[model samples]
Target: MSFLAPIPLPAPLTTRALNALRRDIVTTRLAPGETLSEATTAERLNLGKAPIRAALAQLAAEGLVQPVPRRGWIVSLVTVRDIHEVFDLRLLLEPEAARRAAASAQDRAAAAAPERLDAVCRAGYRPEDPASALGFLEANRAFHVAVAELSGNARLARQIGRLLDESTRMLVLGLRRRDRSGEMAHEHRALTAALAAGDAAGAAALMREQVAASRAMVLAALTVPDAATVA
Candidate 1:
């Protein structure tokens, strides 16, 4: 019904800095492949350099930022290849999770999971508003994670969550350019229907279609950027 507890988080200052930097990176405020300086970022965020350093290291580990030798840091550059790889993995995993999730749905609470996540998504996503991207992505992440969890495989659920996190920048890139209209909602609705009907095969097929659509949409969004091209 809700998310599982994550591992121990960083210290408060580090956590704050990490959250701010991650938000900027994922939303393209800190554009992909854009350089970052610890001092500059610390001053911009009105935080200490130590915390910023810690945050950047964390981001690097998460593949959201790249560490440069002698130079400062750069936001990780996303490519079509990267999207292809992530989505390819998702294609292998998510449909199976959906099939299992639908098969496991035997209670009222289980049946309502998709709709609950849909409410969060509908509230957070607004096509005209760039600021809503983060909330929408979080809701989207929740929706996918819930489905994977319902599959009764903790490892699968965790892997799905990580893939969603890795796809954040791509989703934000697409969302910022208004690349997707109503496709996501329609896919989710159909998937939800299949899940509610306890159609395992149907749910799997719908999820596969949804993931493929997302890959295409995000790849299109990559073309809008003036920095390094993705292909």
Candidate 2:
């Protein structure tokens, strides 16, 4: 008689696990203030504790999770102060980067920047469509990152990349309320026009206003939840 045998498990865990966990934390699917235990996660994920621990550490680095000394990890809480400060810093730095990009970008990248930024604006605020909203957000992120790259500043771009990660989380939260995608797109077009004209000052000024406008809109939503639908 042939005996039935159990099927072996899939594959060994690796960085994919870490990345998946990080995405969940950022997207708030895991929820804020929720504690995560390596053993528990390992069991649920059908993996070992080592991989889970390592993933938790990676999440900690991203500020999506906090290590609690002897305790496990807790999901990072979203605070109004954090939201204000993160966007404020973005406002301070990104405009300068945009100016540098506009000043130096002379070929395909120059043309591409404006087009990409315009696309981001057209994406608008899409509350009912989370994936669509994220697409617009990613496009917006690429626009800023493109500016930093065009500026030819590796160090600045790296720092800005880190800031963008944190800012993205806040943005996803804000998206739950309304869609600022259209206004955002308009600002991008204006900035692009300034860039196309090689007006560094004009590009920078417009970028500053654009960033401030985004921050204010997001902050307004956070303060008044009832006003979530307002853009």
Candidate 3:
């Protein structure tokens, strides 16, 4: 007789639940200020309540969800403050990183960079398919992380990865309001070409422009009380 585990293990189950919940929240499928119930989440994910509950706590720590006194959990709101803070850091960090990437990148990496960007752009957002939006978001984040990593600074790369996570919801919400896939693709191509060609100045300039454009899109997609200043 073949031996098999009777039930799903807690650690793997919690990780599975966490990934599902985080993906939904980051994609804005769970939306800002939306309430979540452990039971409902468990049922929806076909997971156990304990794992879902544990996942919620982890998300709460990540600022993606908040615990209510009476209610279960709520997805945290995307604020103007959040957008400004994140973009400010990106403006300070990413262009420098991109410049360094071009400075350090090998000839073979230069050849590969544009091809990588091409693959990523091919998975751009499709209005009819929600999954495609998720694919685009994930691909975009990975591309940024790769750029940072090529910069030859591990710390900077790790920070960029974390910042990308914080920005994913904003990116998805902006996508919902308006698709910028074409512009994004074009910008990415230019940036990648500059990086691969070992043009440090050009890469930095392109990265700055891309970050600025992304900030504008997210701010425009948001409808906070200070609507006039968003422009």
Tell me the alpha-carbon RMSD of every candidate: 4.7, 9.5, 6.2
Q: Write the per-residue lDDT of candidate 2 for residues 49-120, one digit (tens) a residue.
A: 888887788778777789998778888876777777788888878888878877876754446666655654
Over 4 Å off, model 2:
1-14, 43-47, 69-71, 107-113, 116-125, 224-231
Candidate 1, superposed: residue stretches over 4 Å from native: 1-9, 107-111, 124-126, 224-231
**Whole-model lDDT per candidate:** 0.82, 0.73, 0.84
- Tell me each candidate's TM-score: 0.86, 0.78, 0.86
Backbone clashes (count) for model 1: 0
Order by lDDT, highest first: 3, 1, 2
Candidate maximizing lDDT: 3
lDDT of 1 by residue, 1-231 (tens): 336867777889999999999878877889887999999999999999999999999999988899998779999889878888899999999999999988877854655676775675564467677676677777777778878888899999999988887787788777766645367766777887888778999999999998888888787767764734455
- Ten-residue stretch with the least lDDT total in model 2: 222-231
